[model samples]
Target chain A: MIAAMTNANPNIRLDKRDLILTKGSEVMLRRGYHGTGVQEIVQAAGIPKGSFYHYFASKEDFAVHALEFLYAPRLQRYAQALGDRSLSPCQRILTFYGELLNHFRRQERPQYHCFIGSLSFEMAEPSQPIGLQVESILQRSVDILAQCLTEAREAGELNAATDCVELAEFIANAWEGTLMRMKAGANAAPLSVFLHQLERLLTPSP
Target chain B: MIAAMTNANPNIRLDKRDLILTKGSEVMLRRGYHGTGVQEIVQAAGIPKGSFYHYFASKEDFAVHALEFLYAPRLQRYAQALGDRSLSPCQRILTFYGELLNHFRRQERPQYHCFIGSLSFEMAEPSQPIGLQVESILQRSVDILAQCLTEAREAGELNAATDCVELAEFIANAWEGTLMRMKAGANAAPLSVFLHQLERLLTPSP
Candidate 1:
């Protein structure tokens, strides 16, 4: 039946589209595109497949859009967190970690394993579009962190020797790697350890 | 016919079992288990499906063994690198990175994305057994690094402030994350940047 129905309703509200994106992101993050099916995504979203294709061109297009959708709110949250005027740059950095940890822990399904990293891993050899999408997100993420680090550096919140761009990439890499360890360990302690170590590194030098 | 063919002659000089695993490891390391098929493995190995089952109980079992086979040599190489008596602890640490970078660059496959990390991303939620195998490898890899760090710490080669265990874990996490970035960016410079930052962190203060 046309390879199963997709959520095909253009008139659908943004909420419905987000719902599809959330469910689709989860499935693709876990089983990957080749392994996931439209039926499964629709079932997870509690929406018909017709509603899905209406919102997306194809599985590949949906995956790209889903990543963008998922990242938008996160980037917004990060920007808000970094913009907090009450907290110092270092304190805001700490708050960022708290927000991320809380965000992941609250998920009923812990499959939001960094869309960029997950898709990059799966699509490295198969889909150039997916890889390009992932790279774009990664670059954006790195850029955001770099901006924060640069602000901190300008404020003298970080060591003067720190290279903002490199440290930003390092933090981004650490976050991705820590996520892997947490998922593989199926325990949160590694994440806690990472944050603890990160805080220790960020603690102002006496 | 069954989902996957599994039969082969037992008397072949080149044990079809070893051949299958060797070829299968190459395929799985590159394409992932779900992304590959028994036919592809058998065809690559020039063996029949019957020959495959003669050595493996199932595809999962074959995967488990293939991973073990692939990783054991790596563990040995790491051990040797960490154990090098010719270099000081700090030098040995740097040597490990040098060796890793060289191996990845010189390999027939320029993209030697760690099999354990790659498979962990693809199979973490779907299969607990495979997940456990990946975890064991990760733990072992970290432990090996920790041992080197401990030796370095004891030898007074690292900054007194560095916690060997935590630093080891950090290094391991950084390396894994760097590999993902390297693959995503299709460039090795990120890895070099990571190692350079790490060298600064690990070097004893003057």
Candidate 2:
């Protein structure tokens, strides 16, 4: 049925696949990996079950793709913010977080903002394919932050003694935690608090 | 069916209920709230299907109770660590995290250590009772930390200018984020990094 449908209308098939991935990302982000079912994704996408299989072999495979779909644009934004040479490295780092704060605030549900963090907690166990994907995405994010910190240190924006790699990982870890609190309390106070404290840590002593 | 089973042996029914809750907590912690099924819990506990409803009204209700069950013991541990008068308040605070780090290390799968953090990301949406329960539990945890920080301030263990309430929330938020990283990396590095950063934050400048 899937082959016949795809052969009849390849363009429609591609559109349906994109639709499933988009909707799947939304539901999975909200409900989590194990919590979401393939049937629900199909229903939400308004596509047939067979189409889901045609687009992806399994739910986990679909999740991997869905994550890539969710992350690709955000990664671009990160590069844009962190890669800008005009701003001081420190400003770039803070600006990235400031923009992220605004992004979180703009969310109808701020708690659902970081799907990667959500899935990391929900699926980063038993060290399966899904877990490895989450680990790699997080590592890449941390690497970007580490690069920014390294530049900041070189420019004398940060303490010369500071360990950029460790600090970057620490910041990322704290940010993820702050996101969890934001979701649990249904408030943005934690994010603001994190920003305040993080600035204090990053600033040079008077 | 539930009423008949309960009437048959009330004591045995109570035991069965406890069994179901215990097993449910384990599976839910590993799989997440929506990912876990009633049948899986029942099967894990070696109980029949009718007994599940006999104990709890719905999956949401079961989850709320399961959270309570998981949290009660941990809360007691926190209280004990935070309430110890023999140590300076700073030592007490550090001791709590030290103990937590050890606990995470002891976990065969450390990613599953913080069930509240996982559930916060998974179920802390406005759609259900589970979210409220998670929110309240997290708040209570934060409150305890705030109280400890307040004591630390009085003891001159923390900076005089520190806002204990906000710092408490930040520490708690950062700790949860650290746990998420620990899970994703499947290692103890995040916990160690959190302890290092948290200690630095709490210490007075030389």
Candidate 3:
């Protein structure tokens, strides 16, 4: 059936897949993993219901791919910012978070949240496959941030005595917490405060 | 029908209600709002499907009450801790979080998360009644924390220049984020780090 459908719309197969993934990411981000249905995703993507099954095997399968779709570009951007040698390692970290806060600010919704943080809370159960996927993605992000912090410590841009790994974990966790609160409070004030405090906390005093 | 069902088990009315709410809170915390079914909640509670409907009108109604059921006692406990005059205001703040961290440490499941945080992420849409309930409960907690910070500031335990409201918001958000990370990482390290960092962040310079 999938082959038949793909054959019928060969030119649009790739585009349709992208469309589904993009729409899935948006709906899942807003409604959460359990709240969104495949039908809703198809409707939002403006594709036939049969097209959904053609592209993805199951909702869980779709969710895993949707998460990948959502995070891939963001991860690339994160790497670009963190790996920018033109900026000091510490400045790279700060600039990365600053850009994130700006992105959150530009969102039209009063309640802004992180897709990974939200999904992690909603689906990070031992019994759930998506939970494990979320855990891996989160760990990967923390690892990247830890690398940046280690570089900062080596460059004397951060406190030499600080545990960069632990600090990185704290930063990642704190920022995720800040996003959760931002959504709860229905404002960006928490994001702003987190950014300001994070910069101060990471900066060593003279 | 609900009234008849309640009258049928008049003496156990309150007990059964508590049972359902407790089980509902647990399932909702683990599975999320839309992810959990009414049947699952009833099964977990060992109550009949009829009993669930007898106690609550609908899933959203049940959720609102379940949130109240979960937060009310915690709020009282929080007040008791924060209002402990024997402890310095700063000590009270630290003690509350310390106990919370210990509680998180005691959970058997690696993916244990906050009920309020999970619900807020899953159901905190402006259009949803449950969202409003969650927002109100969260705001109340922040208000309580803010009050504690206010006391600390007045006692010179915290910096006078710090905005207690904003700091309280940050603390709440950061802690929520930390819980999300803790679940994702399957450990209590984030909770410990959050506590340590929060204390340091809030403490006035010598």
Top-TM-score candidate index: 2
Q: Score the docking of each candidate (DockQ).
A: 0.41, 0.56, 0.49
TM-score (C-alpha, index-matched) for candidate 1 = 0.84
Q: Encode model 2's per-residue lDDT on A1-206: one tens digit a residue.
A: 56547586777766787799999888887777787899989988988899899889999899878878788787778877898999999899888788778887886766555677767777767537777888777788888889988999899888898888888888888888787777777777788888888887788644
Which residue segments of model 2 deviate by more than 4 Å? A1-17, A48-50, A106-113, B1-14, B48-50, B106-113
Residue-level lDDT of model 1, residues B1-206, one tens digit each, is 13123434335534655779888877766566665778778888988888888778887788778778889899888888888989887788797887667766665434645677777777766777887887788889889888888888888987666777877777788778888887776667677777787787676766
lDDT of 3 by residue, A165-197 (tens): 777777777787777766766667777888887
TM-score of 3: 0.81
TM-score of each: 0.84, 0.87, 0.81
Is 1 or 3 the stronger prediction by lDDT? 3
Better of 1 and 2 by lDDT: 2
- Tell me the spans in candidate 3 whose CA falls farther than 4 Å from its real position: A1-16, A35-57, A106-108, A111-113, B1-13, B36-57, B106-108, B111-113, B126-128
True contacts preserved, each candidate? 0.33, 0.73, 0.63
- Docking outcome class, model 2: medium
Tell me the number of clashing residue pairs for each predicted model.
Answer: 19, 1, 1
In the range A2-70, model 1's lDDT, one tens digit per residue, is 323443643446678789888877877666556677787888899988988877888888887887887
For residues B3-41, what per-residue lDDT tens digits would candidate 3 score against the true structure? Answer: 546586665787788889988888877667777889989
- DockQ-based ranking: 2, 3, 1
